[model samples]
Target chain A: MDLAVEVENLTKRFGDFVAVNEVSFSVAEGEVFGFLGPNGSGKSTTIRILCGLLSPSSGHARVAGLDVWRDAERIRQRIGYMPQFFSLYDDLTVAENIEFYAGLYQVPPALALARQSELAEVLELGPVLDRLARTLSTGWRQRLALATSILHRPPLLFLDEPTSGVDPLTRRLFWEVIGDLAHEGITVFVTTHVMDEAEHCTRLAMMHYGRLIAEGTPEEMRTEHVQTMVEVQAHPIWPVLQALEKAPEVVEVALFGDAVHAELRCDLNDAEARVERKLQTAGVAYERVVAVTPSMEDVFVSLARRWERPTAAGADR
Target chain B: MGEPAVSAQGLTKCFGAVCACQGIDLTVAPGEIVGLVGPDGAGKTTAFRMLCGILPPDHGTARVAGYDVVTQSEAVKARIGYLPQRFSLHRDLTIDENIQYVAELYTVPRDEWQSRREELLEMTYLAPFRRRLAGRLSGGMRQKLALVCALVHRPEVLFLDEPTTGVDPVSRRDFWKLLHDLPRQGVTMVISTPYMDEAARCNRLAFMYAGQVLATDTPDNLRRQLPGELMQVRCRPQREAREALKRCSAVRSVEVFGDRLHVLFHGTADPMLCERLLADAGVECLEQQPVEPSLEDVFMSLVSEHGLTATATGNGL
Candidate 1:
């Protein structure tokens, strides 16, 4: 596979804290690769290091065929980055912000204007082009930020939680634009806390406590880590979960909405048999029962819990 | 429980000539969780502000626990706990200090303050981190602390504006679990969220867009009302399948979802059209089946029905 980004035991230290501890990964060209983790899990640190905005204390990273540290300028030219925090000039008009970034990237004045128009159409910013960036809605600001980042037509993109504060509809829109860019052979790397957003990625890496704990497609991660995932919607889920806790096969039980999802270490057939029998004996009104496949959330939680075991230390941290 | 804890009739607000809220009519019954769903700038925050008595509406009326929001603002404020999008906790204050401050602000008796603070700290898992500065905590921890602060006064009604926008998945789960428990203690909550999955947890939800309620019901009910049927089609070379579906006359919307494509078609569309189209396109590994629409699907359908394209529309958080 053609490589878009390559990292070798990347490490970053800030005083006593090792922000990113010896992580390694490579993305195939045009792939949407995700860095998944909770807040303060070192995802931002890794992305910053890869973007050449921060120097890694050890190891190396290459972006778009340029060394991240040694050829920072060349890497910057080939990559577009949107940091976690909103980075646009709040005081500038939407059009003015795009033009400022275009000028900074040295896009030709005439070409920049054309690109701006195209981006406005794609992001629905045409009507708000004259409005101050601060006056625009949060979703509009996000789109404008994304439009400015891609104005230079960089071959690689780095977005750190770009959809953080946007509504689901706008977040979906933003992902579509990102997918369009990836379809054009531009490699995309993003970090997010939203699990469903990660489902759209081609490949993903789950990180925790400054280490990469799991990496694969969502399907692969789910199958490998979760044995039996079941969702049961019933009245008084707490009592059901409490009884299930005493069962031998049950490993994890959590409340999801009005439903209680229970994880077991055995296959679905056996787990279902036990659950059905128990609930029937208790005369419960079971709305539904199924041996459901694990959602990205279930997999993430399993991975995090697995990593807490001392015996699994080598594979996790 | 039949009578609403909060009610608004044709509520409207404006900042200068721009309408922030446009005649919103809503009600939140006691012991109920009403999800105030909307894109950013859809006037959710403004409506929430008016209902909570924080901001005076330009027209119409709102009441909290039978107290007028305009004239009896003190009564409205006393009965409700409002958590704004930007939490107003002092950065320099510790978790304990913030909770204490909130209790004082609400005029809780000195005898009851300590126990309430302790219970809140324990419930939010902040007891261990009580001495930590508010600004020093991680995003999830800070959000939890904010929630704890909101609950320390034990107000009868809770209004949370985009409380979980930036929280990690695990914490988001934990937060919602806490919300589910609040009603048992005689507390009513009105929360706004951009996450569709989280919307599933609400007892009832209002789908808002451009300052109007598109749908209001349980998540399952809203999903059943989708105008078109949705199917998840998975196949190798998804591009080929997408192209085939687009060419088929039966298809209405075809959006790429990770490795698969979510194909939407009208009820009158030919059922076997996908198979015939795929066969003609020489697509392999094609798998298709009818599936229930997710909350995201319902959200998209509502937005699209309103002439908003995910590719060319803004959704504020």
Candidate 2:
């Protein structure tokens, strides 16, 4: 498979603090690869390394099949990066901002203009082209930034939390644009904490404490990590949660919306009966308790909990 | 709801020609967590400011903790804890000192400071890091400190604006747990978030779009508004399956979810219809099942029904 991004034992350190600790992953061509982690999980660091903005302390990385360290400048031309913070010139109009990035990327004048018009149409930025970038809403600004990033038509794009604060509608629309780009053979490497957005990616790598904890398709992650998930809808959920916390068969429990999602070590039937007996003994009334598919969020929570227990016990030792 | 802890009637706000919020009505029963959810420029922040007495509504009235927000702004402010998008904790100060400063700003009684400080720290799991500089804490830890500072006075109501947007999953979960614990103590909270999952966690949700409240209901009730049964289809060559399904007369909408496609039927379309369509198109259908509509599906349907463009508009600018 032609890889758009490849990392081998990648690590970054600032003095004693390890940011990206031996992280390794690869993205196939035309793939929508999602890098998911909590804040301070070294996602930004890894992206920066791939973008040639930062150097890794050890290991090797390649973007667009060029060595990140040796071909840093070449990699810059082959990849487009959209940082978490909007980096466009706020004082410039939308058209001017796109033109500026186009010039910086050294696109021919005629080609730049043509690509600008194409992007404006695809991103629906035509109406806002003459408006100052500063006056645009977060959603519009993000769309403009996205347009600017892709003006050079790089084969690979790195978007760091591009839809972080936008509304659901804008997010969906943005993903649609991304999907279109991927269909056109542009590899998209995006980072996000939102599980739903992560689910949109063709593959996902979940980071925690500067390490890649899990990586796979969302369905695979859920099935492999979580055996049986029981969703309990009950009034006054707190008491039920406390009761289930002590149950030996319950591996992990977390709130999912108004319901309590409990991952059980036992099969669905045994777990349901055990949970029912406990809820009844505790005098808690439930609307429903049924086995359900674990969402990506549930899988992450379960993995994080399991990861923490051993470390927490080690701390006691 | 008996004598809502927070109530607004025809509350409106405009920024020059932009109507950030228009005739918005809201109510939150005591001890309930109501989420104000929408996209950027949906006026969630503007509505929050009006209710918290930071920005006066241009029209109508709002009351927080029995005090009119416009007429008795100070009283309203005193009874509520407001955590804006930017909370402005003294980054140079230690977590302990930041709490002390906020307590002083809120004029918390000197006699109650020590115990209240300890309690808030313990509640947020910041007790061990009390001596750490606020700037040095991780994104989640910093938010926890901010939460602790916000609760220094133990206000009856809390207004949090996108409090967990960029935090990691573990931290986000921890933060939600903190918020979940508050309702039991008779603290009413109105939190604004762009996340559907977080919105689902609320006791009630107000879906805002284009400065208007589209709907307000519990998660289950809101989901019931989705017009038809959602069928989860696992098929090979997803793009082909999606296109084939879209051409089918019975399909209302086809959404891509990872490797699978969620097809919403118009009315009660038979599952066999989809199977037949895919088979005719030569797309392999591995599995199919009727599934529940997620909050995202419900929100997407609602937004599209309202003729709101998921794409950005320059009208506000």
Candidate 3:
């Protein structure tokens, strides 16, 4: 199998602080790989290192079959990158921005014009092609940025929270382009805090602080990290959660909207009985209690909670 | 649930030729959390700004905490805490100093400063980081500091605009937990967010699109408006299966959820029809089962019903 990205113990440090600590992962050619983490979790740092904008403090990574450090220049030419912030010239018109980027990447002028039209159609930027970048809305600007980034038709792309503050409609539209790119064999390595977007990737690596806590297909991660969840629909969910916190059969309890999802240590039937008895004893009225599949958010919260508890305990020791 | 903490009728705002918000009507009962949810450019911010008295509406009237937003703008401002989309605090100041500064701005009594400061810090788990410069705090900690500053005056109503957009999942969860605590203290919250999952946490939600309110209901009730049964299908060569399923008359839509496709069909449609379609397309079916609709599903259905295609336009792959 061909690999688009290969990393081994990739680490980055800023003086005494470790931004990314010995992380390892790989992305196959044509795969949509998602790197998910909260802000300041070293996700950006990792992406920077891979994009050849920042060198790793230690370890190695190969992007598009070229070493990120040793062959940094070559790798840069082989990959497209869209940063978290708008990096294009705001003073330029949409067409001018696309042309400028195409020239910078050394696309022949004739081919550049053709590519420009192609991208405008694909990104639905035809109506705004002559609009000043500064005057465009966030959605249109993002589409323009994406079009410019891929103007050279690189084999891999790095989208750093491309939809962070974008409207849902625009986000879906952007993902449509991303999906199309992946179909045409362009590897996509995207980072986002939005769990739903992660569901679009072929596989995911979840980062917290500077460490990777989980990595797998969403289903695998759900099964491995969050084995079972019992959803309890009850009014005053906070109090019910408080009561369940001390229950021996409950592993963890979290607020799921108006309901509570409790991870149970016992079998489903026994756990249901235990929960019923406990809630009854506390006089906490519940509308329903049933076992349910864990959502991606549930898995994330459970893993984060579990991860934090051990670290806190170790700190105490 | 006495009088509404906030009520707005026909609230409208226009920027040049673009209508940012149009005839929006909203009400929030005292002590309730109401989420204004929509895609970007959906007028969530415009409506929020109007109700918060930051921007005067182009037409209509609004009252926040029994104070007319237009005629009694000062009173409305005095009774509410507003956190904008961006972090808007003095980054050079320490967390404690920022809180102190906001307290001073709100004219918080000198006698109440120390205890209120300590209480907010403790509640947000930022007590230990009080002396840390806001600039140096993590994204999560900075948000917590921002929240503390917003709550410094103990306002009756709170307006948070996309407060968790870029924060990590752990911090986002932590922030929601803090917001969940406010209603019990009689502080009503009007939060605008682009995230559907966060919308689920609100006591009520208003789904907005193209500067108009599409639907307003509890998350559960909105989900029930899907008008069909959702079938989750796990199949190989998913792109092909999805395309094939879309051609079936029984299927209303097919949404990609991670590696699977969620096919929404009329309740009277036969599930076996989907299997036959996939088989004809030579896609191997791994698992198929009925599943409940999530808030996202509801949002997608509503948006599609309003004329936007529910699925993003792309080559099936």
Candidate 4:
């Protein structure tokens, strides 16, 4: 299979602090790959390496079939990156920013105009094309940034939380462009704090404290990391929460939208039944205790919790 | 429930030609957490400013903490705390010093704030790092310190503007635990958030779009109000299937949720209709199942019917 990004034993260190530590991952062409973790988890370091912005202290990485170390300049030109904010020149008009990127990427004058109009139509930037970038609101600003970055039609796109502060409708519209771009064979490497947005990725990998702790299809990650996740409906939630927290069979439990989600121990064959038995003995009547499909956030949280146990003593220090 | 901590009617604000808030109506009973949710430029922040006594509304009236927002702005401000998004406290100051500065600005007595500061720090688990510089703390810790400062005055009502927009999932959940505790202390909260999952955490929600509220209800009631049942359609090469599903007359709206297409139908979900549509388009269907509509789903469909789904021309968050 063709690959868009390949990394092996990649590591980066800033003096005594190791940011990206022995990480390995691969992204197939046209896949929407999700890289998620907390802010200081070093996902950013790995992304910088993959984008050819930072050299690894050890190991290797290749982008668009070019070695990141030897072909860093070429790799930089081959990928599109939508940064955290309005990275465009604030004084430049929407159209001017697009033009600047077109020239910077050295797109042929003839092809640039066609690609500009194509992306304009896709991202709905035509009406605001004349407006200065600084004057645009959150939704329009994000769209313009995304449009300008991909003007060269690179093979890979790196979107850093594209819809972080955007509304639902605008986020949907933004993802529509991302969804279509993936189908057009442009690999998308995205990082987002929004769990549902993470759900759309073709595959997801989680980083924590400079290590890749979990990687798989969302479904696989959910089942493998989150054991016997269930949503329980009960009255007077506070006492019920306290009751479940003390139960040995339950690993973690928290309130979730008028209900409580509990993760039960996997060693026991009947995890759900164990929760039911515990609740019954505690005289905590529940309306239902149905197993739930753990969300991407749940999987990530569960992974983070499990990763924390082994290093709880000295990792943070 | 006692008198509402916040009440508004026909509140409106405009910045030149742009109508930041058309007419917003909302209420928050004492001890309840009410969320003003919408897309960026939907006026969540504008509405928030008006209620917090920072910006005067162009029309209508609002009462915050039992004080008229227009005539008694100062009194209203005194009774409430507003935590703006990315709140930048003096980064050079220690956590305790930052809290002291805010307390001084609010004119909180030293003796009053001394005990309050200790309580807030203890509640948020920031007591151990009270001497840490704001710049040295991590993102999550910084937010908690900000919260401690916001609560230093012991206000009756709190206004939080997108508090967890960029926080990682695990930390976000931890922050929610802190928020959930505030209500028990009789601190009513009005928060604006772009995240759908976070909306579910509120006691009530007002869905906003284009400077107007579309609907307000509990998350459960909001889901039940979706025009039709939700169908999760999984298919290989999702772009074609997504387009095919969108084109189908029976589907009210189609949203890409990770690897699956969440199809909201006009009435009952027609499985065979969807199958035929994908087949005619040469797309392979992996699985089709009935799934519950999330807060995002409900909000998207709520706005799609307004025909504002593709329009990025809204006011401001």
Best by TM-score: 4
- Best-fitting candidate, measured by DockQ? 4
Q: Which docking class does model 3 fall in?
A: acceptable
Model 3 lDDT tens row, B1-317: 56789999999888776788889999899998899887756778788889989899999999999999999999999999999888687879998899999999889898898799998888887877778788888777888888889888989999999998877666777788788889988799999887777888898999988778999988878988888899999998877898999998888888876667889996754668888999999999999988889888888888888765321221111
User: For residues B86-181, what per-residue lDDT tens digits would candidate 1 score against the true structure?
Assistant: 887789999889888888988899779899888887777777778888878877778888888888778899999889887777667667767777
Q: What is the lDDT of residue A34 in candidate 3?
A: 89
| Candidate 4 lDDT over residue span A217-239, tens digit each | 87787777776788888754555
DockQ of each: 0.47, 0.53, 0.40, 0.56
Q: On residues A88-193, what C-alpha lDDT tens digit does candidate 3 reach at each position?
A: 7888888999999999999999999999999988887886777677776666677888998899999999999988877667787787788889989999999987
> How many angstroms is residue A12 displaced in model 3 relative to the true structure, after the best TM-score fit?
2.2
**Which lDDT tens digits does candidate 2 get at residues A48-127?**
99999898999999999899889998899999899999788989999999999989999999999999999988887887
Expressed as tens digits, the lDDT of each residue in A1-317 for candidate 1 is 77989989999999999889999989989999998987778898988888888899999899888898899877888899988775788889999999999999999999999999999987878777877787666777788989999999998999989998887767877887887788788899998888878888989998888898889987798788888988888765545755665777777676765577888878777777778787777666676778888888888877776666475322111
Score candidate 1 by lDDT: 0.81
- 10 residues in a row with least lDDT, candidate 4 chain B: B308-317
Stretches of candidate 3 off by over 4 Å are: A246-251, A264-269, A309-317, B248-250, B309-317
Clashes of each: 3, 2, 2, 7
Clashing pairs in 4: A167-B39, A167-B40, A199-B258, A200-B258, B41-B316, B41-B317, B45-B317
Candidate 3 residue pairs in backbone clash: A38-B168, A167-B40
Predicted candidate 2 versus true structure: per-residue lDDT over B1-317, tens digit per residue: 56789989999898877788889999999999999887777888888889988898899998899999988999998899988887787889998999999889889888798799988877776776789888878777888888888788889999999998777676787788778889888899999988878888888999988788999999889999899889999998777888999998888889876567889988985788999999998999999999999988888777777775533441342
Off by over 4 Å in 4: A235-239, A246-249, A266-269, A276-286, A309-317, B309-311
